[model samples]
Target: MIQRPRGTRDLLPPESRLWQAVEQTARAVFGAFGADEVRTPAFEPTELFVRSVGETTDIVHKEMYTFEDRKGRSLTLRPEGTAGVARAWIENRLHDRSHPLRLYYIGPMFRYERMQAGRYRQFSQIGLELLGADSPLADAELLLVLHELFTRLGFDDLQVHLNNLGDPEDRPRYQQLVRETLAASREALCSDCQRRLDENPLRVLDCKVPSCQVIVADVPPVSTVASEASRAHVVAVEDQLDRLGVPFVRNPRLVRGLDYYLRTVFEVVSPKLGTNAVLCGGGRYDRLISDLGGPAVPGSGFAIGEDRLVDLLPDGFKVRVLGLRRLYLVPLGGAARAEALRLARDWTRAGVVLEVELTGRSLKAALKRADKEGFAAVAILGDDELAAGTVAIRELATSSQEVMSPAEVPAWWAGRS
Candidate 1:
């Protein structure tokens, strides 16, 4: 039998409720912050990522599933949503309307990597991007949105790991310092870290291996090694976070492993998940639009991994639906079945969760399944009841039965509860 691909999942009933809750909270929070939703296509031209997400990054270099479409147009499933949203902002001319277009997206993102327990090839993400603003107030607003979102989600003790990549003017000096430090321990560095030493030194700050972690810990913080301008910019973001009463820690080496980020990088991490499974990540990208061949634009935003966020959800709250409380129509004979189906629709119109046997089964079998299915109460339309324009309704939990006009069943149910 064919099966779902590796690193993907099917959300079954009841458990699917968690996804709804997450989406609901996100919508409420983002809407309150004036961020309208942006829905972009699942696929885009391959160069979008190369230009915006950075070709040297792991997402582009090792993870993207690139292929040519029927028309020979190079398209690929989007690994993340931001670049496409940015492209939409440019293509739709949204920038001309507002100062900073606040936007959020929720959807599946694709990646090809070795599947781990919580990792998947196709996972969902809820991300926020604020385009066309550069003030610290904008940064503070974003941080407040993120902080309140986590608090509202009931995730306590979340650690915010904050850092500064420093703006473009001060990044080169920090890059030089990183290269010099990496040169001293280059032999001890991992292959990926070594290769990144020159091109994007900030990435080496994210190594997870035991040996690499120890070595990287000794490397000077990017803030210490960065230019004075970089230092000042980082300080401003911190001051904003403090002013907003958002708690955070300064991790000198907390550079996210991406090339598009120019300054003010940050991560909201949860130590509960065995030391640093990041819940959200994003930073500033001042030159992304220009690099991608659009007019210059400043962007700062973050992506929340839904898979991780769901894992952090408290247990027992499930997808709540009108389940077994449904009125099951067990017509006595063929003609009665037809009448029962018609009655079921009328009952539905009155806001009743009603079920009629679809399978051509014996009355006893239908009754058995109704009881087994845990319906709250069932509406049975045997020939005797149908003759009177009435149905026999049984309350499953109480084992009580009554006769009522089909139209009155919904009101009867509302009264029953």
Candidate 2:
């Protein structure tokens, strides 16, 4: 049968509790924003994504998964998570410690693309980075930790957008007004915007090809090349997200392909995610550590994809794993089935989840298979409660039975429910 592979799948039991309740509420909102976990390395050095996600981005020209390494080198398979957390802050000098170095990460991120509905070609991401500061409260603490992790994951209608992409002397005059407005319609666009109209003219205004969004719908808005010191760093990141009441949306053709971003940029959209793209995106790279050779320390980060957030949650959700209960021991044959398998292995060594009917089922079919596996009580030990040294405790959702005493059925199944 040999199956399961193409774009992966297979997380069964209770659908992995929507990835452990959105990865334990995104690790308790990355420990309430103090950020700490950092584990980068699922392959790299494919020129670190053509030098920090550029080479005209389509996640590095036509979806990366790259190869080469049996010594030849190239290597890839990383497709995002801030260039391996900025190549582990420049090969671990972690800028010799101190000053905004907060961090975070949650795995899996290959990208060959083309899978739909919450997209996945081996996908999953959950990120947050904030290295050193350049204030504006580090872009309002990344829009207040993605607005408190989409309001603690219930995600009721979101949308934070906001953009600036300025600085680095105003992104080369907004990439020369998007290459003189896509060179007067580079032969009517889309051939991947005519090879990205000279490698990334704001990714041809993020084309989604409705005839290249009806030919860049009158082109213009790269905030007409901003720069009054990048318009006061976009009004100091929207006056600190309007002095922290935080709700945003400037959009204006938000570019973000990462050549170490300069001015603020963000995204957190979701009108219940069936459309408006991003569920989390981040910004403010501030010259990604002196353009990846370290020494220029400013940063910002965000990522989230817990496998398309378990198809955007809200179905039967379960994570309450505190079960442990079986204690069957129903011996009715051959020397009380060897003393019901030695008192079901000594009531599972004084603990609990013990079982016996090794396929001889009869105490009402082993208490109906311990009330279909959700057993919160079942300690019979038949042969007439092993001739009264006691052992009954049935409950199984109150079918009520209690006889007790085989050393008080491990303190009566620890005072059950």
Q: What's model 1's lDDT at 20?
A: 79
lDDT of residue 257 for candidate 2: 60
For model 1 the local lDDT of residue 339 reads 80
Q: What is the lDDT of residue 380 in candidate 2?
A: 59
Model 2 per-residue lDDT tens digits across residues 1-417: 999778877778556756767778878887877888899888888887787778887888888989896778789889888878888888989888887888888888888877777777787798888888887678787778778776766665677888777777776777778788768778988788888777767777777767887778777776677776766877788888888787888887777666677677777766766544676777887676676677878788778777766676543233233243445556655656767666666666877666566777777877787777666666656577677767677676768787866776776776662
Q: Any idea what lDDT model 1 has?
A: 0.80
Tell me the spans in candidate 1 whose CA falls farther than 4 Å from its real position.
70-72, 225-246, 319-332, 341-354, 361-364, 367-374, 411-417
Residues 213-267, candidate 1: write the lDDT tens digits. Answer: 8887767876765666656776788898888789999887787866777667888
Judge candidate 2 at residue 318 and give its lDDT. 31
**Candidate 2 wrong stretches, greater than 4 Å:** 1-13, 25-98, 101-116, 119-126, 133-172, 186-205, 210-260, 263-284, 287-297, 307-378, 381-417
Q: Provide the lowest-lDDT 10-residue window in model 2.
A: 315-324
Clashing residue pairs for model 2:
none
Please list the Cα RMSD from the true structure of every candidate, rounded to 1 decimal place.
Answer: 3.1, 18.9
Give model 2's clash tally.
Answer: 0
